[model samples]
Target: MRHDDDGLIAADALDRVTWAMRRAEWAAQAWKDQRLRPLGLAAAQYTLLINVHSDPGLTGAELARRLNVTPQAVASQVTRLEERGHLERRPHPRHRHVQELHLTDAGREILRDADAVIVEIERQIAEKLGPEKTSQLRALLDEVADAVRAP
Candidate 1:
């Protein structure tokens, strides 16, 4: 990589797009972690909570697929959250050996607080990008996501 006028990495066309995406992901994760740290949550943990919050009854296998982690990893984390009273596992309806994750009352409250923190960060992003660019950015990112997900 070469340095541009501001001593930033000067990437070629393709690398520029990929590098920008990766850098944005890393920066967002770090910022989110910092913001969520005071709530005693890591980015990954918050991700788990938010996903379950979005979908009330997701199994660990489903979560592993969504989070792209191994089953054992999710199981351990889910156990910790259950112990913390932030999450609970309920028997899946009509399933002999399956359980679904759901947020506890405590977990819902935590998600509310965390959403305030996250919303601030998002608003900061929108304010910087402005309405038009932010809208365009969302469309572009979605297009890229669709492309990558397509088989």
Candidate 2:
């Protein structure tokens, strides 16, 4: 092993890490492009819709918290979906000014389509990685997330 004159070893480690991150991002975008693009939904919008549909009757603030986005961002997405007739906003039971979101019939139908796309994506990933390795990868990624968030 040769070291640079600056006494820095593992110079390539940084490059490798950068490459890995970019590769993972590219793979994710590719999957989203194939799965969500034809449905007229961006990946972020699809995720928001799915999350809201799964946790119905949640306020925009609550949804923003769960989605780790600003309330305004959630509101913007919700507004678009509402205009498209996929979702609706109603008065919250407890909050006076806050509105709770619900998926309309069309929203549910779109969600089903999105779910099918997601299922196909998962199946393709599983076929490529195999079940055990896929699980292992998930565990390892979770560990990384935990470590990153640790105090």
Provide the clashing-pair count of each candidate structure.
0, 0
**Candidate 1: 10-residue stretch with minimal lDDT:** 2-11
Q: Cα RMSD for candidate 2?
A: 4.6
76: Cα error in model 1, Å: 2.5
Model 1 per-residue lDDT tens digits across residues 53-80: 9999999999999999999999988988
Model 2, position 74: C-alpha lDDT score: 90
**Per-residue lDDT over 58-89 for candidate 2, one digit per residue giving the tens place of the 0 to 100 score:** 88888889889999999899988999888899
In candidate 1, which residue pairs get closer than 3 Å at backbone N, Cα or C atoms, i.e. clash? Answer: none
For candidate 2, the per-residue lDDT at 54 reads 81
Report the number of the highest-lDDT candidate: 1
Model 1: lDDT of residue 77:
85
